[model samples]
Target chain A: MIPVCKEIRKEILKISNASGHGHIPTCFSIVEIMYAVYSNMKHYPKNPLWEERDVFLLSKGHAALGHYCTLAKLGYFDIKRVYSFGSFMSDFGCHADRFKVPGIEASTGSLGHGIGLAVGMALAFKLKKTDRRVFVVIGDGESNEGTIWEAVMVATNVGLDNLTIIYDNNMSHGRGLQIRNPAERFRAFSCEVVEVDGHDIDALGPEIAKRGNKVRVVVANTVKGYGCKTFVQDQYAWHRRSPNDSELEMLLRELDEETI
Target chain B: MDLSLHDERIVMILGDVSVYLFKDFNDKYPNRLFNMGICENTLISVVAGLSSQGLVPFVHTIAPFVTERSFEQIKLDMCYNKFGGNIVSCGASFDYAWDGATHHCYTDLAILRLLPGIEVIQPGSYKELDVLLRSQYDNGNTTYFRLSDHPHEIDLPVQFGKGAVIKDIGAEITVMTAGPLLGNVLEACRDLPVNLIYFHTIKPIDRELVARYSRTKILVIHDAFGLYEAICEVPNLRVSYHGLSDEFCGWYGAVHDIRRKLGLDPKSLKEFIKNTIEKTGS
Candidate 1:
């Protein structure tokens, strides 16, 4: 693991341990994808609302801790403030609120929502005749919502080449609504498709950068918990469970020992 | 949209509802108008995305599908995210009454007004829609413009959040209505011993004007659900609703059939108002 993304995973662990909230396993699944998107997308951490900047939305909002950590590491805000995640009156909540956070484009908690916002934004760029693009990260589980496919269909039909959707294929949907071949489905919907390993930033970054002829989709195959063995092996148990002191230490040790 | 000429940010996204109506729109502003298919949810979501980029978008379609089916999209993407746009819905309430109950839309204004950071307008006239749409479209909040095919010819003052009092005679009874139903409502209360009030805006429900008639027994008469519920928001007012029973409007022919059946026609309204005046001994 790269040091920054590892550091993000550690930060997510520490915050969720301290805050007693968050879908930590889900957050871990998208660490590298989140890092890859931020590192590759054209955005200013200091000037978040800069008119000419490209927009990124974390559509599967349960992984917001990962998104907040990604933005903080990218210098959007101080990492120290994120320890208050899910606390009362805290800007950083379980789901990202665009008004509260600097880089968050839209407040999303409900599945199938943020992708639609991303579609609208991509269409806006097309209408405005701007080179600015939109990036959105949706979860495998969130695909069960019909609105996700609805958005993808619109993005494809409108030929929004500027919109790049990153599907965090963490198989969280395997327990429920299964999308067996997401890439084929996306291709059937007429999107430019690329399959990538979610944890490998080297593989993810280029896909994030590649703008295609139609709506581009990067279906990133990822583990539900990439860094820690305990969460990965027993994902459903730790899906929404925060760690105690001992578990946090064990997870930290497991993360430090991770070689991938 | 005349705003389309000067303000290049105004993009109209339709849900395959009124595509032919905007043939001129497509011709005049080629790239600005998009018939964004039959997906209502996607249209609102896309409009939010467009608004996030400082672009003003108008997502128009049939009232129920766009407003009811895509209610979550509007609540989460547009209102909650504070992405400003214009949501112009045609076929208000029973405007598509011939298309049956699924095509009917009366809960739009009522349900939409419940969402925070939204402006709900049921414009009764073309002048009202034109004036109010121009006035409020760029204000940077989710503003819903419910348009009707059966617009009244009444030329009332058009404002974004204020109410228009047509008749404020100091009678003990007051009749409040909104949107195109004002034509029937006005004729119903024309020679009655009561005051009549009309509104284009619903959310910031003109609390002061509504409160002004608090001393009177307010009769909320309309063709739909929202105006009655909105009037009930004002405190200490003896308000009673005279529209929309708690069952589906099962039968359908035209908007007129539904209106007459629901007792929203001028004759029924007139008789109801006269009876209210008699019952209360006003």
Candidate 2:
């Protein structure tokens, strides 16, 4: 799982370097969370739209490079296809588009939309009496949207225990204001909040697996740029900036040396 | 009711409005109905999600909130993603006139028409609303149904993508419109020697009918903005438009009073049509 995360990060960097456009740090921060969820979740890559498959939505749609790489690694498509991330011929855009991509559950780029989409899917699953669960990965910056809280209230009120939310608490917001105490806020919404180290798969795997009668929120505390040394502990500038030539070489070298 | 009864996958979602109107609907299918409070953005995105799951979701709210407040969601989630859902909006134009500009929607048709593959329908009466709703649901496309309080007793059968000739006496001038403004246009042209055409579906604009009446002068009297430009695609048609102008109505009054102030009332529309006919010498 750790090696897969490293590989996904490498692929994301390659796509960003080729396209000269992507949310690199944002995608890097969520690689482990994506790896943990994809490794443990029930999904058939060949049959992407299988009815009984558990749903995964990247609410923070800017981190689409990470999602594309993860889906490619899971054998949903060829990894080579993702290299055309920003090109007109490519199905993958900077933001995830569901119609073009097979494994993407929903088209998301605008903030505060994915939570409601997940809630609706979760409600449908409950109505159909299916045991399938829905996992949505949302950014902490995206949490500032009021619609997210509206979905949270409804999910808790409806007792959608089959729905799980993984908040990428990278402590970096777009407008330079960090969301203070997201776990307490989730608790206020009556969600069973579970705090975990976002980069550590051992801590994230078990927390994501836990399900009960209430909506569960796993707050994964992580750094803005997880693996790369240039922007690892940096703030908002690295959110979407592409790496220069030397920076790209340095990132690839760092990934090679890091013992997962 | 017939559509929902036949297809159990059809669900209705509300945005803290239209509960009284949907009481009977909720009583019949309680599980299929959901009230998502006042969150219009969530209402649209949730409907998109439900549509993705192969369920036909019909979302209802006031016009401005559903179409304007959540415009991005409707564009990206529903239209861009090509998800099929029905957005049924009430309080169109100035129906909720006393509630001020916040509740009224005058540009929804123009905004939604720009979205690819979305069918925009504005029913002039209860009969048209029922027929258009059922037709769009059966087609299972991304459609927007504009509902209003005006009820016109017309004999024309409501078709999905076609226009109805309300009073076609082959006159020199043709007046086209949709929604509640159809009633005003009909009353305004009752004594005039002109032809009247009402459109239940706005987006497609019934191009054939527009081309048929293109040799003569045409006047479009509508409550919403941009209908004239949308329907005037025919080159030969000498078109003059009378609808809500670019100015915002920030005051409060009855819908008719507001329409009169905006030069859309029956009296103003009649005078405008007479002036147009006299100027064209048709």
TM-score to true structure, per model: 0.97, 0.96
lDDT of 1 at B81: 84
For model 1, the DockQ equals 0.87
TM-score of chain B of each: 0.98, 0.95
Which 10 consecutive positions of candidate 1 chain A have the poorest summed lDDT? A120-129
Candidate 1 docking class? high
**With candidate 2 superimposed using the best TM-score fit, by how many Å does residue A151's alpha carbon deviate from the native?**
1.8
lDDT of 1 by residue, B1-282 (tens): 578889988888989878888898899998888887898988999898889888989988899999999999899888888897999999998999989999999899999999999999999999998899888999999999999999999988887889999998899999888889999999988999999999989887899999999998998887777777787887788999889989999987988888999999899989988999999997
The alpha-carbon RMSD values of the candidates against the true structure, listed in the order shown, are 1.4, 1.9
Tens-digit per-residue lDDT, A104-192, candidate 2: 99889888888888998888787677899999999999998888998998889778999999999987774665678999999999999
Model 2 misses residue A178 by how many Å? 2.7
